[model samples]
Target: MTGPIEGWAGPASLGEGSVLTVVGAPHPVLARLGDPVDPTDPAVIRLAADLFATMAVSPGCVGLAAPQVGVSAQLFVVDVGAHPKTATLHGSFALCNATVVEASRWRPGREGCMSVPDLTGDVKRASRVVVTGQLPGSGQSVTITTDAFEARALQHEIDHCSGKLFLDRVSSAHAIYQRKVYL
Candidate 1:
């Protein structure tokens, strides 16, 4: 289903997915830039599904990127519907070669990642953003304009696909914290 945001018809269906292992911090793949992929390729479709499945199985994970799963590809999955901070819900969707076209209203918010596992940071991100990406399977292009937590989640995942982590966005060591809970 399309989110409350206008014009997004939502993502095309990605077939069956299997949970893939999430690579932790310091993994070489996480530091390398992801390569662009053909959205309609069978392998790309499967990777989209697998990212979604892996996110689903991980507690408190709202997004996942191919690089986090040890693949250096420009792809990620996000679903922030259940988060209390989310004001715009896009449901679960995978985007290939996504790019941020516009961003504004910068603010710092607590962020974490399944790949990092042990740290959370206060990162400055746009509270409102416009992003464009191609959907897997159909290779359909979609533009999403969103705000609040969903926007933050999207930016976070996109950063992962670009080989950057939340830690990279923190202002200083004071902005980073050791995560005390994992569930």
Candidate 2:
């Protein structure tokens, strides 16, 4: 199950390990999409923290993945609730080896990507999703069912871990738009 179709541009380059990279793509090692993590490991925890920090500083970013920051690891952070206009996400989720177990058969929505900057496209995605992942520090598996904007945000970030850019999944380029000003 996938939600509406969206598109993004390619090769948003920043400083090395500055949260966006093109070299990270096409590297098979970068696509360890979902693998378990030892939550207690300080490095893992720090990685999650750094991801969150990066996300906070990034413009219009709702989520981020380790690979986006030039770290090939199964880690990502998401917080849909950070902005007022969007539906609130339940704070931050430091996910490791996150997997979608279920998804809703519903209409698709628009999406964008930090790695693929300046372009937004219509993409089909699961309107709702049930995801399972490990939470940092607890080493416990947690499941979350989300829909609408939140679901879209999660799917986009997770795609980065698998080297799947939003542009790859876009249903059409017709809806692509320029982000004139990012707040």
Candidate 3:
């Protein structure tokens, strides 16, 4: 999945009561995947909008979730368009009530997270995945099947909604990497 590099200045921090909460290691909301969006509620739209904004401004970020910003809703945003390798991705998706309907049997992939800054780990993930979710504002449900990096990115964001970080799924702490610079 590739697309143009539309510049979006990500948000600095999750606003108070705005859903991007960093609850310690295991948050209850993070444990449970989110529910479908009503689309009629203004708060959900606002949270989605803020999440998009946050992802846009954060340098090198391909996706973001409501839990990352403290919101507990089943909402997340993804864009792989900027990745030079996955150029077919338009790099923009606003997902609500996202769920992985299918996944390929596979080993692990190196993964990272925005909530847990400066750490990377070899987290197990499906090599391929089919996901179903709605586009924010539009209330239109879209399902896409993806593999490789796109698949990995989607799974990472979905984990955030379920309160599961990449570190939690890592097979070994020795596989984790430390960030040398802030992107």
Top candidate by TM-score: 1
Looking at model 2, residue 33 earns an lDDT score of: 54
Which residue segments of model 1 deviate by more than 4 Å?
A: 1-12
If both were scored by lDDT, which would come out higher, candidate 1 or candidate 3?
1
lDDT of 2 by residue, 1-183 (tens): 222112211112111122233333455644555445676677777777677667767767888888777666777878776565455355556677787889886666777777666677788898778887777655677777777788787788778767677777876667677756745
The C-alpha TM-scores of every prediction are 0.93, 0.76, 0.79
Cα deviation at 32, candidate 1, in Å, is 1.0
Superposition TM-score, candidate 1 onto the true structure: 0.93
> How high is the CA lDDT of each candidate model?
0.88, 0.67, 0.70
Candidate 3 segments exceeding 4 Å error: 1-35, 85-90, 105-107
lDDT of 2 at 54: 75
The 10-residue segment of model 3 with minimum total lDDT is: 8-17
Best by lDDT: 1
What tens digits encode model 3's per-residue C-alpha lDDT throughout 6-100? 33222222222233433444556656666656643668767876776767677778888887766677888887767654524535666778889
Choose 2 or 3, whichever is better by TM-score: 3
